[model samples]
Target: MNYLKEYNELTAICPKTYIKYSEPMENHTFIQTGGIADIYIKPKHINDVQKIIRYAKMNEIPLTVLGFGTNVIIRDKGIRGIVMNLEYLNDITVNENEIIAGCGASIIDVSRTALKHSLSGLEFACGIPGSVGGALVMNAGAYGGEISYVLKNAKAITLSGDILVLNESEFEFGYRKSIFQKENYIILEATFQLINSDPAEIREKMDTFTALREEKQPLEYPSCGSVFKRPPNHFAGKLISDSGLQGTRVGGAEVSKKHAGFIVNVNHATSTDYLMLIQHVKETVKQNFDINLETEVKIIGEE
Candidate 1:
């Protein structure tokens, strides 16, 4: 929709920043399989983020804010309008047991910060590959800890450029869901409360979780980590494995042999390949058993 013209207008407001026309989504995503975006921008400042959002809202242009890519699939035909990436907002600071983290800060980095300072609560997140904002938006958790438990509050910018400080309860977090998912809110920074612990203990815990993830998950391949959420009492991986879908391939997208839950890009897989492979596995599992596997990963963009 003449994104070039819109991009020119945007640069007039927020100049001297990273902006790209027809930027490849594959370069931004973890799975490395997506189409070109009409306009992709990485705002340098919070005011820049606000200005972009306000501009999009004022002009009735579509806007999609993204963090460090994980747990999302951008479709093969690409996304329309502006794709605002928050990767450059990364900053992290510690204040005793409280950690102030920018939306773009990696969850792993936060965990490491906790370890560095002998904080304990973030040890469970040592293996996650999401940014702070993405984790907050999704309530991302691992090894029995979720963002809801540790989050004190978050600074978010509304679509109209108003700032809102959301408390933990406002997050409405549950099983990979949060208010940010339902509302037009862009996370700016997150405050988390952790606990003091022995440095050795924290390091040991982080190391253990890291080793476990490396051992069980298909870390060697390019893929969305876990394709499906655990349904009821059944584990997603066990269900896929029991359905005999392990090592199943669809145009270079293969259900991981090591971990059935992962769909890896074994070859130069397309977005269609991943989506098709996910559908095939879902159908097979549903056919073999009665359970319908709901995807944990968010799929976006167009066909």
Candidate 2:
């Protein structure tokens, strides 16, 4: 694919935006793995995003949206076509009993904004190291709460460049799934309804959750967070631990000893190492427990 030609044409059409060719995906991902993106572009505004999507669709070029890169693994051969990053769209606002956040805004930043305004429901997302777009797409949750519980509505761009607003019901949010995933919608911003509470109380709850995550998770290393989704009536971690796969290494990647649910880069792990370790864990767990563990982390790009 001649991504350079597409990028050149795209730049000629939208010169105000930042565009790069053959940008390293390693720097964009939380795991610090992967190869390069054929074309990486950061749209400064919603209009810019719309134009890019329209252009990609019109030219039949593949387009991928990247958030904060918390819950995905890009392959070693990199991504093709255009990689649209929403990092520049980090705008947020808090009104009474509601919070509005752009796609690029960090979930932690949203949680902090909510806390500052004494909003209670967002306390669960205080430590989720993903962007609003990623959180909405996955219905991301933690500490017994989820985005579906608090989400009021979301604005998204359809594959054809038409903008649409979807309510909670329209989003069809389930555990680790949403309509955004099914329909290939690009999330723009989300509005969440939260309860009014005392700032001190909200901060205390967020602090507690943050502390617990730090104590339990292998946050010390680069990782794609939880590698597998929770199996029916059982946690993925317990399954891996029961299979004696804790601390198992494939190249520089290891099943985290601290949290068997996570596969962390203990050293300088490549994307290949991570993929191999993930496959090994899935196969081992399935053989031992007769449970086909599904990955919660999104794998993208090329091998």
Candidate 1, TM-score vs. the true structure? 0.98
- Candidate 2 residues lying further than 4 Å off, grouped into runs, are none
TM-score of each: 0.98, 0.98
Candidate closest to the true structure, highest lDDT: 2
In candidate 1, what are the lDDT values of residues 134-199, reduced to their tens digit? 998888888888888899999998888999999966888888888988786899999999999899
> How many clashes does each candidate structure show, in the order listed?
0, 0
Residues 1-303, model 2: lDDT tens digits: 777788899898789999999999999999999899999999999998999999999999989999988999999999999999998888999888999999999999999999888788999999999999999999999999999999999999998999999986698888899999999999999999999999999988899999999999999999999989988899999999999999999999999999999999888899999999889988998899899999999999975
Which residue pairs in model 2 clash with each other?
A: none
What's model 1's lDDT at 236?
A: 94
